[model samples]
Target: MVRNKLILAAAMLSSAALAAPAAAQNEQFIPILSYRTGAYAVNGVPYANGVADYYSLINERDGGINGVKLLVEECETGYATDKGVECYERLKGKGPTGAAFINPLSTGITFALTEKTTTDKIPIITMGYGRADSKNGAVFAYNFPLLGTYWSAADIAIQHIAKEVGGFDKLKGKKISLLYHDSPYGKEPIPMLQVLAKKYGFEFTPIPVTHPGVEQKSQWLAIRQNRPDYVLVWGWGVMNGTAVKEAAAVAYPRDKMIGVWWSGAEPDVTPAGDQAVGYKSLMLQHGAGKFLVHADIEKYVYARDKGASEPGKVGEVLYNRGMVNAMLGVEAIRKAQEKFGKKPLTGEQVRWGLENLNLSDARIKELGFEGMLKPIRISCSDHEGARDGRVQQWDGKGWKVISDWYTANQSETEPLVEEVSGKYAAEKNVKPRDCSKES
Candidate 1:
């Protein structure tokens, strides 16, 4: 009887030892702050879905990076900055990984999180929208606005117009109006556009549209009276549809009206239907759903019933942008794994991964996303990988690329990035670290 007891005790001790290491191995937690129902729900929902779906794919397909399963906990922020802050505080204590990284899909949320992420050491992945200067990694270390900024977008749009008008000199005295939503996100492109206008000797018109811009009688009235040569729409959600309809009502030449990527999405166009034909928009990189990556996503995740959220929006423009968001997030994590040896990586380690993400064309194809995300090379000083973008046009049914990758005149933008980033850093009493050596 004593001998039998001894054997049972030995088995218990062995099991306990095995369980301790297993528990120690599992420590990574990834928090996803999403706003499925909000003023910007039309765009927010799909992007959030893409973010969550990529995490799901990573866990189920790859077995949780180096044995540490990625634990994704969603907190609805409703795209509100306060709610997003609350979500960040709530999720920051989940595990040792301490909120590996966060993708706050809203620009307001991105701004709010930018202030806090530095202390938390959790990188905020603002793939597209945010403070454009946050791309200066040395100034905003924890913020990664991966694909380019409003400044870049605005610059490219102007470049496209210049080429269309024969030359920059040919644009003299031409009127270009900005029909923008009256918000920080909407106003982001103005300074850059004005800078371009000054350089090219074009007239700049600023037209403000209220949030959820449905009541645009005055805005369209102004556009009609002014009769600007070109109209640039910077809006979101229902605002986009409203702008297009109002433009149509004014008999504005659809081709002459250009939209920022966010303004020309399916939800924006589908609501306006045939009226939005021939509308142009500056695509940050990818648009609509013509790329090969769209097919793969439709085949792999959506086909197997493993979509981010809604299965129906697998190939939509905003949906694909969400996919690109996921791609960047995953690639950053994978890059972290290469350095940190795998899962259960700290946020700082992941920040390093994000700051040095190098996605090649071949690798993009291998991951079932070739044309979705441009190959970005991040660094300690430069968090944005591809500062160049393209122009796309809506052809009633879908979008087609109209221009190739064009880098904005950085001589015009870099100083602005530094100035704004410097002001932010000064106000916050934070001295941005010099990353010259790392660069």
Candidate 2:
């Protein structure tokens, strides 16, 4: 009986010893709002997987960032705004620091959560989408359109079109048509496009594709009849694939139609088969393929049989972008830790880190993201640290970068950003921050 008691005590002590390390590890929580079961699932799944895999890599390889274990919980939004809000509300206050930051990944959800994040003292990260004017961080304090925004995209699109037509002056009298998803995500680029059209003296027409964008017979018929010089497709999900097919049905030149970042994934053009060949689109700094970061993910996350993506989909375009998104978040947390100690940080604390983020070229290389990211510097006044984009063309099997990086002409977009953000500040009854006064 005494021998049995000693064994029991020893086992209990052993259990406690194992539990102590886990309990002692400070945790930083990130709430992911994903749409893996909607029309956008084909495009959404890979992105969500990439984000998950990167976090897993950090935990598996580095034992978490500087010893703060990262915790991620996903909630299904189904690409619905209401569902997204519900997910945000349910997960906001979770973990130690109350969700380091929120990546809505949807413009509708970003718009809905923008005010909520401010009230909750959290930051809403909209990496290449959302309201372009939100880059005015002074007015939209909680919103960070990190890498680029729709305005930058629109400006880049026009710049590419100009290059093809010879020069900016050559754009005069040319008809540049926009084929956009009817939602806010698609329409966000119109204003900037219009501003560019007027500046360059080009004919601009905006065409809207209905939600889900499956049925577009009438729209294609109009495109066939109108025969615009260039068609800019601002689509997402299955819409992107369908658009490519519809453009083919009309016998339009695939090379003439350029899609935005959301429309440039594998799923977008694969369904169109050979029709997708020569189809061009914008790259969100990075394109499809693996880098050093992906090598680490394969080594750390996949080797452990815990990867979120499928066997061979790790280096896809959307997946790589998702990894970039998570890397930015992790870097922000690491930056925040510099000021807030080596521990889990609150959302507000993370915001400061995001604002002051400076991802230098050498640092990006060290992080194994050499060709995938540009040197970016975020500030209190400008959340969009990088406003450059590249053009890629589908070569029937995979995407190939076709053009050099084109930096958006901020001289044109800046005035609009100021005007619109000023109006938003007045309507929301929020005073814009004096960025110069901020650290």
Candidate 3:
């Protein structure tokens, strides 16, 4: 009986495996490890919606890239690393193109998948977060922290603040406090910020809060005492609202507090509503609201009333980010198909596509994401296709760009990437694969 049960279980497993490929016979599968209901849901939902919506639009509106549909399946991770791994294992092989690419979106999950992708031969695209050194594609192949990372954000934040204050020299006497989530994601930006503070003679104060941070009264009490010139918010979801409310409670000027892009969204501040007005955030290319392609998305997908997982969230900021994620993923697949011929491309081929992926100003404008993303040209040593970002200010109602595009100080980041990536390689005893001699 036990033997029979084993046979039946094996058959069921085979059936599921076989079924996935057949289901994706003429399509590319992109697995989304989305946490739509979790501590991070306020941010994660819109982002996941945008990603899934874009995939849906591509399949329905564009008729599935050269006659191949894009199949995106979501597995909720609740921002948990272990759940993310489980989802990755379950969905990676089911995709038509060997799971094409993954954007875990969570720093913890990204790190966990960093190991998994290496073994699975898939590309893990963690845009604007994750390990900044993963930009050294030579050292950390299969991991693409595209566009920017926390270090980039920190570098740019300092540069922007300096620009606002005339120069770095003017920052000598100022005190800046970092209100960070007590996790790897929040801590990632510290080294760069501290390095800058030391160079410019500014006082740096660190304030940390546990995740899902509803209790920040004490942290704010410290901030209120220090009364730093500016506060940088490195929070997500409910934490963002709580931080804003706390700032309001302590009578901190809303304008002086700046949020990381993820922290400055509608969901983050909207809960605090008008009370958190004038809050500013750093934007990594795309910001809130609809762009050029959004209208088409609404008409094509939502008008037909076919939503991915969430039907109503078509063109919000996080959703647009998700869409952009899907766009990048699809574009990479398309590029791979250009070289690898067509459907059923392998993970390695997709990697080639990702590394070689280019989004020219003309192309971005053409696609209707002109102002949404800086022109990107990815290569072997650099996985982050672009390194520039803008700042936006929140009116009581919406967001508006307050600054032009600015590149992070690569002079500061290059050495750091090399040092950290090199250490990672040495620790693992892994040598970087040479892109020049690809077979």
Candidate 4:
């Protein structure tokens, strides 16, 4: 019986190995760790679709990035950290040169894979989310929080709040509270906000909400009783919509509440009905609605009926973010091809490309991303390239940009990044790379 079991196990392994297609030397692999069935599905599905569709657009229109065809695959994580790590490990070595890089949509998964990917030499691009301190690329070499970080988001949100209440001087003695999801992703901005509160002289409070966050009456009740002047909502998935609804329930003014880019989406407000009106959130460079890139995605991918998202759902907030994330990766690969001869490149080569990524204004307009992105450049020392964001308010019907773009006060955020990243390097026993020595 033992001999038979061993033989059967070998046969099963052979079959599973045979199922995956043989890798083509000229195809670049991109593993998408997505969550389409979970508490966050409403938001995740659209973002996942956007990611998948952009790759499809490249293949359909440009015949892939610089003739090196993209080999994309999706592994659902259901927003679970363990499942996300499993998906990453399983798909990381699929193509001829292994995965070009990975976009772990979940912050938890990004945290889990950071050390592993460092060993594997694969880049992890967390466009607008992930460890705020990971922006210190000198230490976290393989991590790229490209567009922004939680610390940047925190600073920008406070800047907008300061603008709203007259000036920075007016924040003295003001009460501000943070309604955060009880997880690493939600807690990331706490230290930065604390620093900001001290600097601006505001009384700060943090309230934690359990996962899925469907039950928040107690938290909102406390908010109703205390009535903080402004609440910075750091939430995701159902938590965002629930917070909006609960705020409405407690008679909290929606205008006084602000959310990070993660918390701002149509799904978050639509479920709250009229109560969501006047609610505001930050935009990470781009907002909802279509731009030139959307038109191309429609013409190349959607018009061909090979699109990933539902009809007319292609240009929503999260979907646009996903597209932007994918575009950045493709551009990185293209940038790599400039040096690596355009064939399928290894993870290490892609890392070099990411570290050297420079998206200029002219390049942005040429790539059909004119309005969706801004001029930004990445380097060996700084991984969070662009920290500028705009404020948008949700009307009863849709979203409208209400304020000018506010760049994160780097003088304030950089020192904290250095402190935290320095501690991380010490704990991990890592000798940071010297950017000046890098070619």
In the range 397-427, model 1's lDDT, one tens digit per residue, is 7888888778877888888889888998899
Over all chains combined, what TM-score does candidate 3 have?
0.93
Model 3 over residues 1-439: C-alpha lDDT tens digits?
A: 2343234335434544565655568777777788867788778867876776787788778898777777656678999888998998988887555688888888988877787798889999988889888998998779888888888898888877888888889999899999999988998888888888888999998899998898999999999999999999999889999999999999999888888877877888888988788888898878877678888887887788555534445566787788788888888889889988877677778899999999898998887787688888888888987888888888888888898888998898888888888899999887987868653
3 against 4, candidate with superior lDDT: 4
| Residue 333, candidate 3: C-alpha displacement in angstroms | 0.4
Pairs clashing within candidate 2 = none
Q: Which stretches of candidate 4 lie over 4 Å from their true place?
A: 1-23
Backbone clashes, each candidate: 0, 0, 6, 0
| Local accuracy of candidate 2 as per-residue lDDT tens digits, 1-439 | 2243234335433533454545534888888787777799888888888887888889889988899888777778998999999999988987767889999899999989999999999999999998899999999998999889999999999999999999999999998899999998989999999899999999999999999999988898998998889999999998899989999999989999999999999999999999999999999999999889888998887887777767588899999989999999999999999999989899999999899999999999999999999999999999999999999999999999999999998998899999999999999999999998999
Error of 2 at 86 (Å): 0.3
Candidate 1 local accuracy as lDDT? 0.78
TM-score of each: 0.90, 0.95, 0.93, 0.95
Candidate 2 residue runs with Cα over 4 Å from true position:
1-25
